[model samples]
Target: MQTHELIKALAADSRRTGVAMNTVWWGAVLVAIVVATTIFFALLGPRPDIAIAAQTVRFLFKFVVTIALAASAFALLRMLSRPETDPRGLLPYLVIAPALILTGVAIELIAAPAETWSSRLIGTNSLVCLTFIPLIGIGPLALLLLALRHGAPSHPALAGAIAGLAAGGIAATFYASHCTDDSPLFVATWYTIAITILALFGALGGRVAARW
Candidate 1:
């Protein structure tokens, strides 16, 4: 309300500069895909029988969950990048993927016998799942954290975490193709853990990078 405060605010606004948020975000999306895909191929490409795998509902479901997560997190992170955006209204979107995964899990539990449940959850590549999702995601996470610095986010840490979620989703989508484990149980457990790791890293990175 004061003249000095008004001048200071105007000065701050003037100092903010660069590409439009849309341009920056879309650019980040493309770059992230490149970065994640590069890592995926270098580490592990799609499974050998992906053509056959494509026929299964469970195999296809992995993409549905991962893409949903990426889309939701991307939308929220974009909102969080702006100081004026509330982000709360969009919070529900984040749960959609998780809920879908849970539903898949429930369906899996019902369809499969109890004896096989443990094997389904454990999977053949639990270690690989843990290792590569984070590995592939780290680059995109860093990219997003850096991108967040371009905007005046009120919740830098949260924004960074969402960036990680987006990165995780992207990584998982690629990883899912190569993964032999198609059970929802495996995805719900291992995939969630892998993504959470990236989210944690993103939070720390956000705290440091997005700080004003």
Candidate 2:
């Protein structure tokens, strides 16, 4: 075939594939994540005191921060899904949410009593936070990795890691409702650890699953 015809054919193929991937495949994966998460939350239920305005607000704050991080990381993941796309421009922005939360943590510490700080930091639900966040995150992480397969990612592990961040963020958002600990210290410590663990899992999974 002539060069012009070959180019046209490839372009048409790319467009068709893009549409299918974006519409059908991506939508299915998103719905799966939502359904799975909703089921998990229904079975587990939010903390009993969640109706209390003060407690609910605290949980909501944590959820907002986590979702923000997930949103930014997911955006980056989408960009990285395409080969040769550099995420440098948007990468730095990922820290904004965490930085703001950490600042709040610092202020909280300064305001609280010295001895109480340790208890707040160590929160009663540390173990639960660690366990549930990753547990809930597994499905989303898998789905994100599956989505990444639709594109050509140059650095599979890195892409996977970002997907993990997105998954972790999402998991943390759901876990927040069940978590009783409202202090920023608790969130900064345990939530961060849980999210990081998922990110590591993503890295490992990416090495195997995301390989082009």
Q: In model 1, which runs have C-alpha deviations exceeding 4 angstroms?
A: 1-19
Backbone clashes counted, model 2: 0
Off by over 4 Å in 2: 1-17, 24-29, 53-57
How do the residues 48-129 of candidate 1 rate in per-residue lDDT, one tens digit apiece?
A: 9999999999999999999999989998888787665566777797998999999999999999999999999999999999
**For model 2, what is the C-alpha lDDT against the true structure?**
0.79
For model 2, how does the per-residue alpha-carbon lDDT over 9-128 read when each residue is reduced to its tens digit? 645554667776576446734864695487567656677777884445556778778888888888788767666566676668578668868877888878899899999999899998
lDDT of 1 at 13: 65
TM-scores for all candidates: the values are 0.91, 0.85
Candidate 2: give the clashing pairs: none
TM-score of 1: 0.91
Compared with the true structure, model 2 gives a TM-score of 0.85
lDDT of 1: 0.89
Model 1 / residue 155 / CA error / Å = 0.9
